[model samples]
Target chain A: MLIFIGLGLNDEKDITQRGIEAAKKSEEIFVELYTSPMPNINIQRLEDTIGKKIRVLSREDLEEKSKTLLELARRCVVAILTPGDPMVATTHLALRLQAEQMGIKTRVIHGPSIVSAAPSFAGLHVYRFGPPTTIPHPSPSYRPTSFYNTITQNQARGLHTLLLLDVNHEKKCYMTIPQAIEQLLEIDKEKILENRILVGIARVGSNKPELR
Target chain B: MLIFIGLGLNDEKDITQRGIEAAKKSEEIFVELYTSPMPNINIQRLEDTIGKKIRVLSREDLEEKSKTLLELARRCVVAILTPGDPMVATTHLALRLQAEQMGIKTRVIHGPSIVSAAPSFAGLHVYRFGPPTTIPHPSPSYRPTSFYNTITQNQARGLHTLLLLDVNHEKKCYMTIPQAIEQLLEIDKEKILENRILVGIARVGSNKPELR
Candidate 1:
């Protein structure tokens, strides 16, 4: 059996009770925190809470060596813990497909995700939000502008856009709200983004969550 | 203080640990289950689990008699329990805004939402989903065909559409997957929806969740 559990947002305690139960029952646990920047995540605290030693999987480990993890699931109950809702990322979905192909039964324990949390915290109606977009930090040779187009399309429909900032956990780099705004300004050659109200949220699902 | 607590997708146990803590600490609890159809929702069971007598709110109560609820919040900690994520409904968002305007503090305890769960269970990529649409049961002189248009718009962008079937809790009428698909077929005069694959999920977040 292969179980995919979401760790929710921020710290260890944000995990749902159902998630904790699954973690306790699983014979093997693998956590992937590198996909997103969870600033308050403490591996030690999470391990202590679940009473299990979790093998942390890097991006390469998940993409290239997933068969090793699948092999374990073939024998015993294996849980893959991820920040936010599991399978929100394409890679995680692909991994689940691979597990299914190998005749492993799979289940998902959903958690509170930023996709819904952001708008709720911002006092915005979730129904009015169009499909969300992501803003990635530009590289020297390549910069994607599809996010800008998505924002414009949503704005034209009188809908709000939730822009997710890019994260590189390996390099300890995260794109801040200010950096995201700056990128938007740089990409707004058509001047459609001018004077638009933007809400910035930090540490959502935490006790002292901040919104501006 | 007023807190909006999401009960998640299915039953009382689907409420997160954080949500349970908030419910325990709350002086008064109000639940509105009319907005969505949660097949496993049992008000008596939920009240028993929380160890509190919950005042159930109807649409008229929430929209017309909101001040009465807000008055309770002014004096004590009041928690409003909602199915799925609390603020997903626009009416809930409006109530929160009203509370804020009346000098009441509000917070949200996020939970597992169908917005994320539907795609995850369907084995479809979450990022590939466009803005979600609702399929309401047709009434004389009030057949809404916009949902069909929305589906076509999403399909044009090579994205999938998550269609939420409308429910009338007071009438105990929930739109089934067959009803929704039949409605879609009737409204697709443009013939854009023919032969498109539709995934139906039942009892999500339950022990016997079924997806096809």
Candidate 2:
């Protein structure tokens, strides 16, 4: 069996008991933390809690068909853990599809995700929120405003948008709220529209998440 | 202090370890099962798992400014547990806002929600899901098709719509997939939209969640 365990938003303890149990039963366990940054994740602490050693998988490893992992899963129970909900990243979903196509059974140990947690913490109705968009780190050749378009459309419909901050794990940079605001403001000035109601949440799913 | 603990999707074990810890520290813990139905929920097993006595609350108790609950929260730590992630409903958000207005601190111990999980299980992108809408049981006095509108809009944008199956706890009626499909097909004929791809997930967050 192949199990996808979500480590949730914060540290090691954020994983559900069911997730832990699933991880404990796995012959091989892999963790990918690059998708979303868990500010308080401790490898040692997590290993201690789960009583199993977890090898970290890079984005490339997962994107390259996850051959070895799938092979292991086909032979024995294997688990792949990820930040927030395990299958949030497209690559993971693709991997699951591949595993299923290979006739390997897969299971998901659900975990707390910022996808739903953020709106709740902000005391906003989740249903009123439209499709979520992520603000990318704009380079000279690749500047995008689709995220801004989403916000504007949602605003017209009297809906809220969950604007995700871009995370570049390769650069070890997690986009700060101020950086996202600066980027959005730059887009606003470029588009000549000033209407914006943005809620900046920092370190959500932590014990003391700062929200403003 | 008031804390909202989510019981997650299927059963009591779906609640995270953090949520369990939060409940254990609470002076008073309340469970509101009317919002969403947890088919496998066993109050005895849940209470034993959390090691606390949980008092069940009616929908009215939570909707009516949460008078008694908030009163106790002001004096000591109190928790309100609900199926899936707490705060998905507007009433929970209102209650949290009211608690904050009354100078009571509030915290959310996030749980697994179908909002994100369903997309993952279906191998669909969570970000591609537009505004979610619930299909309600049509009554003689009220027959609404707003949910169909949501799906059509999402389909136009090449996005997916998370159609929530309505649960009228008072009537002990949970909308089955076939019932929702029949309802949607009726609306599809009325709206003249031939494009539709609906994925139904049952018993998610359980040991066995059937998806099709």
Candidate 3:
């Protein structure tokens, strides 16, 4: 059996009791950090919390050599740990499809996600959010124009956008609110528009989530 | 202090460990079910799990009679329990704004939500989803036109639509997926589309989440 356990958001304690139980019961555990960042806790912290040693997997290991994990699922309980909710990224889905194709039983232990948590934590209405857009750092060669377009369209309709700060795979960058605000302001100046209402949330799912 | 605790997608166990601790420490606990539906768990089960009795509130009660709750918050720790993530609905946002206006301190406890969970659980990519649209039962005056528009648009772009079912306040109606699918098919026929892929999920946070 393959159990995809969501480590919730932020820390090791963010995991549900059921998810913890599943992780403990599993024969082998693998933590994938490529999907989303769980910056609060480390592999050792997770291992201590769940009482199991977790082997970390990269994008290459998951996408290229996933058959070994699938084979492990056939013999024993294999738990795949992910930040926030598991399966938010397509790699997780592709793995699930591979598991299904191989006839391995699979289960997803749901966890708290920022998609829902962000709006709630920031005191924003979900219905008022048209769509969420990710704003990346402006590059000379690659400018994410579509993201700006989505923000403008949603703004015109009086909808809030969940501006996800871009992650640079090459530089190991987690874009901060200040950087995002700067980018938004730059876009506003270039496009000749005013700043819409933006909410900045940090450390969501923690006891003290900072909102500004 | 008023703490808004998201009860996540299912029973009391769906809450984070921090949320459970907050509930235990709270002097008064209240549950709001207007924004989202409770998945297969009753007040008794919740009280049993959390070891605290929770008073239930409606939209009107949370919005209109909120002074009493705020007063309780001022005196002691009060938890506003909600299904899904708190502040997903406008009512929660309004309540938060009101609390801010009255100089009442408020905190939010994040939870798993159906917004992203619907697609995540269904093995659909969250980023590919366009602006999500809700589907309501066709009425004489106000039919669910946006439902069809969103579905068709998402299909055209090879994206998925996480269609939230409508909730009837008077009858307390939680529209099931079968009903939603039928409505979609009817609307799709009018638009001359056929054989589109659709996924339906029920009681997502529960142990036995029905998926089709």
Candidate 4:
């Protein structure tokens, strides 16, 4: 059986009891660190807390050599763990679809996700906020202009946008609050007509999470 | 202080380990029924699983007579149990704001919510979903044409709308799949929409959930 477990958001304890149980029972555990990472915890802490030695998989290992993971799932109970909710990234969905084609039974264990937690913890109405937008790190050579456009459109309609910053999991590069604010300010500089109150959320699913 | 604990989507076991621990220590535990309900488990079963006596609070009790709940929070650790993630509702946010005004410390323990669970279970990309729209039950005297307008607008922008069925906690009325479909068809009345695929998910966060 192929099971996808979300490590929730912040720390080892952020994982649900059901998710932890599935990870413990799995014959092989694989943690995908490409998408996102728990801000307050690391692989060693997760292994100690989960009581399982989890093999880490990079983006290339999962996407390029995915046959190895699928082959393992064909016979044993393989648990694929991702930060936050699994299937948020298209790569994970591709993996699940591939597993299904191989006649492997698949199951997903839901975990606490920032999509809902962001609005809830920030004291914002879930329904009032519009669709969320991701903000990647800006560079002089290449800036994620598409993300800026999405946030601008959402703001035009008087909707709040949950901006997910870009993260480089291999280098462990996470977009911090100051960097996100700087990127937004830079976009606002080119487009002077936009003015919207942006909310910054960090360490979601943790006690006393930083919210502004 | 009043601590809002989301019971997650399905059964009592879906509650996080932290939520269960908090419930065990709380002097009074109240479950708000108006916002949402755990479909797989009832009040009694939840009480039995959590090993605590729970009181179901109506919308009136929460909105009009919250003083009792507030007072209980001041005396001991009071848990306000909610289905799905707590503070997903506007009233809960208002309650939290009120608690702040009264000098009561509040803490929100995040839980699994449908906003993230739906896309994960449906195999849809989380970033692809636009602003979700709720389809309310049409009234005899009032025909809601705006619901269709929202759906059309969302489609025009290449965004999928999450059709949340109406929840009538006062009458124990849950808008099911068939009922919601009928309402949408009645509102739109378009021939091209009959074959449009719509995913139905129920009992999320359980070991075994239904997906159609």
Candidate 5:
């Protein structure tokens, strides 16, 4: 059996009781956190809470070498923990699908996610928020303008756009709100957001997440 | 001070440790369930875990007479609990905004919401899901068909639509998946959804929610 659990946002305590129980029942517990950032997360605290050492998997470990991980699950109970809700990142979704295809039982233990908290704490009606988009770090070869296009489309439809800033896991840096705005402006030929009052929320799922 | 805590899907243990801590810190805890349904929720278990009685509020109490609830928050620490992630419904958003306007501090403790879990458990990519649309119960005066429009727009954008079935609080009946699909077919004039393989997810946040 393979159980995918979300560790919620921010710190170790953000995990739900259901998640903790699942982790306890698993013969192997694995955590792979490169997909998202929670600056205050303490890995040690999470290990203590689950009462076992969590095998920390790198992005390559999960994405490229997930076959080995699945092999473990095929034989015994295994849990894969991620930041935010599990499977929001397609890598986890791919793993879940692969597991099921291999005839392995899979379950998901839900946790707090920024998808809900962003609208909730920002006081924006959830229904008004359109499909969320991420402002990616543009390279000369991979400068995608789709995120900008998504914002303009949502604005045209009279909806609010939820912007998620990209993360640079290797450099241990997160894309800042200002940095995202600068990136957006570079590709915004229509100037749709130039005069719009866009709300920026930070530290979601934390005790004191703020909206600006 | 007022804290909006989400109890998550299914049962009391679905609440994160962060949520439970916030409940324990509050002088008064109130739960409003009319907005959504969790058929397996154990109220007594929730009370026992928090070591306090939870004041249950109806739609009338929360929507019509929230002033009394806000008044209490102005003087003491208060926590309002909800079925899904708090403030997904605009009612909780209104109350939180009111408390903030009254100079009372407000915080949110997000839980496992169907918004995230539905996509996760169903093997659907969260980013592909567009602005969620709800199938509202139609009264002769309130028979709105805008949900069909939202789904069509999402399909045009090459996006997946996340359909939230309506909760009829007075009748204590949640709009079933088949009922929602039947409602959709009734208004699908252009045959947009008639041939589409729509996925239905039920009992999300529960121990055993199924996807079809």
Candidate 6:
């Protein structure tokens, strides 16, 4: 059995009771933090809470060495934990499809995701928000501007947009709200966002979560 | 102090550990089921899990009589329970604003929301989903076609749309998947959805949740 569990927004206590139970019962547990990284996540504290030791997996481990995980899952209960809701990332969805093709049963245990939490924390109605977009850190040779088009399209429809900041867990680089805003401004040289209001939320699911 | 807590997608166990702690600490707990309803939710079971008596509130109770709840919140910790993520609905956002205007402190405890869960269950990428829309049970003189337009807009961008089925908790009238599909077909006489695949998710966050 292959179980995909979400670690929610931040730290240990954010996981649901069902997630905890699944973690405790799993024969092998692996966590991948590349997709979404919690600001205050402590693997040791989460291990203490679930009473299980978790092996951290790099992106390559899941992308290239998935056969090994699938082999273990085919024989025993193997749980893979992802930050926020599982399967939201296409890589996880692809992993599930691969596991099923190999005759492994799969299940997803949902958890609090920033997709919903960000708008909620910003006091924006979820229904009024358009498709969320991620602002990737631009490379010298290649800068993507599709996210800007998405925001423009949403704004044209009078809908709010949730801009998820890009993260590179391997480099310990997380995008700050100010940096994201600067990128947006650079992308929108037309000054379309000059009159727009942007809400910056930090450390969601933490006790001192801030929204501005 | 007023804290809005999300009950998550299904039963009592679906709520995060933080939600349980907030419920236990609240001097008074009120749950409004009009916005979203969980099929397998048992009030008694939830009460047992949280060790607190929950008072059920109607839409009017929150809309018109919010002063009463806000008054109690000013004196003690009051928690308003919502199915899925709190503040997704504009009514809850308005209530929170009102509370702040009256000098009441407010916070939100995030939970698993269908906005993310539905796409994940359907094996669709979350970023590929456009703004979500709701299909209400059309009344004789009040048929709304905005949701259909939203779907059309999303389709134009090669994005999937998450259509929420409307429910009337006061009448115990929850819209079924078939009913929702039929409504969509009726609203889109242009047959925009004739060739499109619609994914129906039921009993999400339950032990026997089904997706097709």
* lDDT, candidate 6, A123-206, per-residue tens: 877778888999998889979998999899888888888889999988998899989988998888878899888888899888
Each model's TM-score?
0.94, 0.95, 0.87, 0.92, 0.97, 0.96
Off by over 4 Å in 1: B42-51
Model 3 B-chain TM:
0.89
Among residues 3 or more apart in sequence or in different chains, the pairs in candidate 4 whose N, CA or C atoms overlap within 3 Å are none
Pairs in clash, predicted candidate 5? none
Error of 3 at A97 (Å): 1.6
Q: TM-score for candidate 6, please give it.
A: 0.96
- Which model is ahead, 1 or 6, in terms of TM-score? 6
List model 6 lDDT by residue over B1-212, tens digit each: 99999888887777888898889999999888788887677889889988999999999989998889899999999999998889787888999999999999999999999888888878988778888988887889999998999899889988889999988888898889999887887778888888778888888777677988
Q: Stretches of candidate 3 above 4 Å error?
A: A42-49, A137-144, A156-158, A168-171, A184-192, B58-60, B138-146, B149-159, B169-172, B185-193
- Global lDDT scores for all candidate models: 0.85, 0.85, 0.78, 0.79, 0.85, 0.88
- Candidate 5 residue A192 Cα shift, in angstroms, is 1.4
DockQ of each: 0.59, 0.77, 0.58, 0.70, 0.81, 0.81
Error of 3 at B212 (Å): 2.9
Q: What lDDT does model 2 reach? A: 0.85
Q: Relative to the unseen true structure, what is the C-alpha lDDT of residue A29 in candidate 6, on a scale of 0 to 100?
A: 92
Off by over 4 Å in 5: none
Q: Write the per-residue lDDT of candidate 4 for residues B135-155, one digit (tens) a residue.
A: 776778977666676667667
Residue-wise C-alpha lDDT for candidate 1, range A1-212, written one tens digit per residue: 99998888777766776788889999999899988777778889888988999998999889998889899999999999998888788888899999999899999888878888878778786657778888887999979999998888888878888899999888888999899989999999999988888888888888788988
